[model samples]
Target: MSEHVLPQTELEAWGTDVQVVVCETCDWRFVLPAETSLPRCPHCFGTELELLSGEVSELPYVAPPEQAVPFAVSEAQLTGGIETFAKGIPLPPKDLNPAALRARLQAIYLPRWWVDAEVAALWQAEVGFDYEVVSHQERYSDTVGGWQARKVHEGRVRWEPRAGRLRRTYENVMAPALEAEKALRAQFGDYDVTRARPYHVDMVRRAPVRLPDRVPAVAWADAEMALRRRAGDECRQAAKGDHIREYRWQPAYPKRNWTLLLLPAYTTYYLDDEQRPQPVLIHGQTGRVIGMRKASLKRAQRIALILGLMALIIFVLSSISLLAVAVAPPLLVLGGIGLLVGMVLGLSALAPLIVVWRFNRPRRRPQER
Candidate 1:
């Protein structure tokens, strides 16, 4: 790997007295200020965040980001997204409302490996070019009242072996720096990287930048693969082919530089019925919200209790009415109706519990990477 130096001023902004902290539960690490007391991990909301005393140099890349996609989500968009998320839950916890979430929201930046490399490669692939074939078929047509010749067109590809030598510089190639990157994108969706602006010191000073957990040694392979795939596409385009396959490359990188590219996101959490924090992530660009909308068991149980009490009251009134039938014979019909209504009310007490149980039940589903 090629070495790159970070500016002295920017390095100070990252904090000279900074310490590395790793969440014991999620194993996600972040570089934070030395005096900053973090009660919870921003990524997973884990309470056990261990502060590492290792030197910054021990980590793979400590240099500040070269570019960043600034948070574009408006205040209105953020509130609207939270409202939509909350509405989906049947009985959300008290702290899960939009007002509470907005107040606790913290702006943070997630890391991605952005590498610039000069590549020289001997590449081979099968390039395919599209062509059209036309044939005439004899068909009986009701409109013509006689046999007619119809033309049929079919599209096909002709594959040919192609080999070439490429020497090019690819910059800002993206690769996952965190293990949870795939799962994060699957939930929050993609960012518009093209809109990234040059990074400034103020960006890090205001919000925490999650450091890359996957070192350059691991991410380099992914970066090289992306470069090779890009080269293959360009080669096919140069050959005037429609498709390419089985691309293989033997490459040498004369010079390469690895830097972090930060993407904007907001992290905030709401307490569930059990008082455990449930983390919520919002896309900084589009205000897309992704998190567990767990129904509150406490709230559900409260409703059930109220229903049970009402049923008991109805039964007591029915018994009194039934006793009154001795004094007036016409009161017998009212007593029967009261008993029936009490039974229905008693049965309805279980509705909230069943709804909450089904909503919060653990279902078999694909676990996000």
Candidate 2:
């Protein structure tokens, strides 16, 4: 593993009064206001949380964030989004509704590492320039009744070897700050980091900020990869080539600056049929919602009971009609129809339960890290 030690200049004490709390279940650490009372882990709904006390420097990444993306979605939009999400669920749980989810919604800022570095490297590559070649071919045409010459232009590239030393500064190359960032991105997709505004203490004074678990040492590898990609693109531009191949570089970082860029998100939970919390995450900007949609087995059972009772009533009426057939022969047809209808209704009574069972069937989902 590559290790990038933080310089003394990069370490700073926490600016806002906050405490670090970690979820025992998910191992997610968050920085929240000291007075905030958290009943459960926002990410996993785990109730086992431990409050940690330590100096800022003892934390893996101590510097405060420089920028953050604010919640662009309004309350009405959030409510509508949740409503739309609930609409897709079949026999939704009683607690899983727009009002409940919106009530429990908590603002959270996810962490991403923003790195600025001055890189110096020796690079080599084969640069290719586009060229056109003209050629003539013979073609036969029925109208001409003779072989005619056809001209063709073919595009090709001319390769040349080139090498040079590169000294450049790259800024704000973002990398994941949390181990679960991949899962989060898979859930919420990517954010437009360029739209981020300068962060302020008030922006996250009440909201919890998820702290970085993938510290600079582990994140530096991803940063280095991003830097190399930037370096290659610059080299290709410098060579003024349409294509480049076998690009290789040896880079050294003389100066590095590390900072944080927080992205906005919201988390809420609702109880399923089993009374377990099912977390719902919403994108702060786009208002996209993602969560496990569960059907209410209790509701399904109640519907089945009602249907079964109706079927039983129909069967009793059919039995009375059959007995009346002893006196009136015309009642025989009515009694048979009633019996058939009653049987059909009884079979249909199981439909709701079957649908609910299918809807609530367990499936694999990405585990929160």
Candidate 3:
């Protein structure tokens, strides 16, 4: 929308602590106020619009992201991934193919926050130590000693005082900005956050950057809990004799480093035949793709029916073989027919699976009738 076209009153400015910009043209909003040098709106398709609400508001309620996993997966790899994912579902629609659907792939940076803190405390715990001891056993010797007893020896633990400090740069522990985080992970698998880098907006040039919605206080609390979990795990690993079950500590002089990080992803929306927006998510860094793809249930059912009919044929042939066995005692011919029919039914299963795989593949090309 042109600046001359937008309404005068600004809608409420919403989003995180960083820069904020409102589109005077369309109602669409964006983080990071528009640069004076840049003529068009970056977020809303570059509509020539005036900034209705250029007011900067403190994003105290949101946690800025710290770092991110750089893009490792390429477009080809993502396409292949999408193709593989489409193959597993049952009875899909016909219009869900890579060629038939419109897919737009743009990289997006998701928001996350990191916290660092220190803990100091007076703690008390008994650490375990293992020792071996022998006990005399008296037992009956096979034939010579009629009444003898046996003693057994065993190893046991001794309590000891243990103390330690834990520290680490916890990387890639994630928070989801996307509404479909679960479904995305289900499709692309898990991310290893150890490789994350500090957040930089320019790195994510093409797609939108999501800002955290969590307030600093709440995010800090969450980070503390996460840090404690990590510390507990370290304690258990360091235990020599047995696992560490419980812990008590007082944290002191806690200093925190807060960061805003971005995760990469590609998002595209397609208008199905019904004109509904069907969105797809791709792992921007790894190009691992996952989305809803369509397949023809009718086609699959037809193939399945053929296979089922072959199964029926196999059963019939087997029955005939049994009958022939009763009459002629030589039923090898009927048995061979049964085997052939069984093979045909087995071959019938491939069609549906193939149909599904094709359905999930990202449409590099548009679908045709």
Candidate 4:
């Protein structure tokens, strides 16, 4: 009966599944499905989160979700995140300010693939267990009879080849169910899905439900790999008292099904210098934002020049202190001044290096007219 209920439309733009969610302030529209209960947004999270027992709900799809990792980043975390993204730039577009970016940040419901699999796996690996002993020898000497002199310490690890049958049902190991998996991963890193919750749409509002560019079938290998990798790593952990050198897991995954899971992201865009669009992706799980930023080479140069001048001033001051030390013994003062000079030059060197690092980090993609 559940198999008959699973929605398997030929992978296309989720037109009917997505609704255009609009912003009241700017009237910007993001196509999102109408959800009843969902994870709280990192930027706009408030009450209705918890009391005594943690709430568990189901996503309105075929599969059941076992976990939902709520967004862990606080507002301060977001500020630091945006700052890191803006650190280095060559003449950043005038509009690239945190205030502007924060004002435009939109909460998005990125799709996650929920996988239900009855995995029967046979795995082989080298297991290692460790032991250590402090060994001391009783050596009697003529002068000091029966005296404890030196203690020897050595470590030992017991390793052996092991094979086992691992049969387990992974309730909902999230596979990348979205078609836009690459773009999303490029924008935001992997989420901690152990904290995933059953999909409820009510707590969150603005959902930039960009339909998955990848179909479920296209992502099956990825799905299997995710589960297999997890199973192997965890099973190896169960081997207990041994370090796993190498492992191979051949799992027979039968009755694999899907669920529509949602994740959190703060998406915003800032126009670059060339009037091109630059998208910002914030991790709904961690509040880590990844996006391209333009740095001001001129600003870097100006800052460097000022620092160089400061270095020169410190050098002169150190020399002056040394010369004047005849009256006051400026060894400490002059050394302090020299240290200050070195710090200035070091800072000057770092400014341009930071600028170069940022400029090369993300390549600017020109928008086609």
Candidate 5:
């Protein structure tokens, strides 16, 4: 990641006095002005919100973002995603369709921390240099009684011990700003940070921005690893070596800076059969949807019931035809056909019922790391 420094005035704009509110139902955090009117929880739309007593600056594990990727997905694009998701469901709920889902869409910004640092380190490694050796091969053919000579080139690596003491600056090493960073990434994939613009309050208007849950202390380990990888690349380039192996380094970061980066996403939920909210997430830049596909129990049951009635009617007609076989000998063939048809219809009726059962069964999704 490359560094883009914000001007002093822009940095100071994020330092305004703000109040933090926590939702009692969903535990979602919201940051607003101290005197601003309270709003319902954006995640669950619950009215129960509590104001944190202390100042926003004293809030633990929360920091303002320095950059953000503004939402690029329009409402029309999100409707397309929802429509695609609504398809292929065996018995979908009425509210789970595209229009209803789109109505509940909420813009959200996820967090990633970018760290900048100045480091001084002494590093040592075995650097490998590539070389080619040419050798001549002689072959004798029995038919010709002649010798043939061929040249072969083989590639080889030469390893040499290299050591260096260096002072360097590394910037924009990204680390997860959220505790559930892995799950969020698995849910929404990666955001294009190259398109990230300087953080402005206008970009987040009417949107819920998630506070950073991973503090700098916890995130520093990841940042350090990124920095070391960059240092290794620099060392290889400096030595003019093809590869570096068994690299070791002792580094001290004399100065370090951490800034938050906000990634755009859209969140919404649909009510399931039991009227429980099931959350859905969509990428703001790319129209990707991630969530559970719920089956409607009522619809499944209704279809099963209709099929059951048809099976019953077929069974009754077959029974009546079988009785008529005794009255007329020619009717025996008709009776046999009716019996066969009834059995097929009866078996087909079980399909809808089985589908309902399978769709309603509890399924366990893979746990995200």
Candidate 6:
């Protein structure tokens, strides 16, 4: 891997008392206090690691982010999201209610790296321009008993071979800062990154900030791909073509700049049957919730028990009615009614039992990304 250095200005912000560690297994970087013991990488749970011993200049600390999209979701919005999530659960755990979930809300900022690159490359592609062709079709209508000419417009593309040299600079092309960045983006959906404001310490004071784990060297390939895509888009626009295909380029990035960008989110957890924490993530900008929708087996069982008791009571009454029928003919009518009612109640009991079974059915757990 090519070595990349952090700007001198960013290094001055770090205190000498802080220790930076990198996991050898996953290449995850973490910043800790000097006295703290090293912990496994949270993403991959990698144990094998090495600690760095050098001046700040020798370390590969990414510069702190300059701008961030602050949390736009209000407390009311978050509550609404939780309530919506809890609405249809058959038998939700007591701890999974809106109030309980709201109490555990935690703010977090996830990191993404933005890269700027100046590139000089020779590129070639088949550019396609769109055109419309008009054709006439002859059709016979049974009602009219006549042939009619129908005109139809069909869209077509004209392709031409083109070759050119591209010398341009692409600014703030995005790259992942974490291994699961793509999954996170898919979960949260897109946000207006342009709305980000200059980063302020107070904005993230109470929230936990996730530092970048994917270094620039590892992320450079993604950056280059993004740049090439941008170049292809620009090329199509320049050629006055609707599409480009079979595009290839040999490019050299003469200059590159890397900076961190933080995105806001809320993270919390609810315990599952095994008392293991199951995470629920809500988008800070959109209030979108993503997590497992779990049903409580204990709650389902309680409901099933109540229904079973109701069915048993009806069955016992029917048995008593059968004995009463021996006394008189009129009593026989009562016995028959009791039998019918008991059968209905017994059938009704299955509804709750089915609910219990459905709620307790095994399901795939939600994955964290």
Better of 2 and 4 by TM-score: 2
Model 3: residues with Cα > 4 Å off, grouped in runs: 1-66, 88-91, 100-102, 125-189, 198-201, 237-241, 269-275, 291-369
TM-score of every prediction relative to native: 0.85, 0.80, 0.53, 0.55, 0.77, 0.81
Model 3 TM-score is: 0.53
Give the top-scoring candidate (TM-score).
1
Candidate 6 local lDDT, 254-337, one digit each (tens): 888777778888867676656655668888899998877777777656666776677777678777877877676576677677
Ranking by TM-score: 1, 6, 2, 5, 4, 3
Best model number under lDDT: 2
lDDT for model 1, please: 0.81
Model 5: runs farther than 4 Å from truth? Answer: 1-19, 24-26, 32-58, 129-158, 295-298, 328-334, 350-369
lDDT of 2 by residue, 1-369 (tens): 113546332322446666678888887777776667765787878565568645555667645577888888898888888887778667888998888888889888888988899999999999999999999999999999999999999999999998999998998888899888887788678887778998787765757788888887698899999999888888989999988888999999998887778889888989987888898998888888888888899998999899889989989998898999879988889888888998999999899899989877786862221
Residue lDDT tens for model 1, 1-369: 244453232345553456567787886777666676764787778575678656656666566677889989999998888878777677879988988778778888999878889999998899999999999999998998999988999999999999999998998898898878977887778998888887776676656678887877788888888898899999999888999999888999999887678899988888988888888888889898888877888998999899889988988888898899989887788888888888898899899889889887885532121
Candidate 6: misplaced stretches above 4 Å?
1-3, 6-63, 328-330, 353-369
Q: What CA RMSD would candidate 1 show?
A: 3.8
Among residues 3 or more apart in sequence or in different chains, the pairs in candidate 5 whose N, CA or C atoms overlap within 3 Å are: none
Candidate 1, after superposition: displacement of residue 337 in Å? Answer: 1.4
lDDT for model 2: 0.81
CA error at residue 90 for candidate 2, angstroms: 2.6
Error of 4 at 8 (Å): 4.7
In Å, residue 200's CA in model 1 sits off its true spot by: 3.4
* Superposed Cα deviation of residue 328, candidate 4 (Å): 46
Q: Least lDDT summed over 10 consecutive residues: which range in candidate 3?
A: 1-10
What tens digits encode model 5's per-residue C-alpha lDDT throughout 1-369? 323242222323545555567788876676654555766565565454678655556544454577888788876778878888877777787778887778878777777888889999999999999999999999999887899999999999999999999797887788997777877687667887889898776654546677766677788888899999999989999999999999899999888887778888877778887787777778888878888786787776777677777777777877787788778777777777777777777677677667867765766752111
TM-score, predicted candidate 5 vs. hidden true structure? 0.77
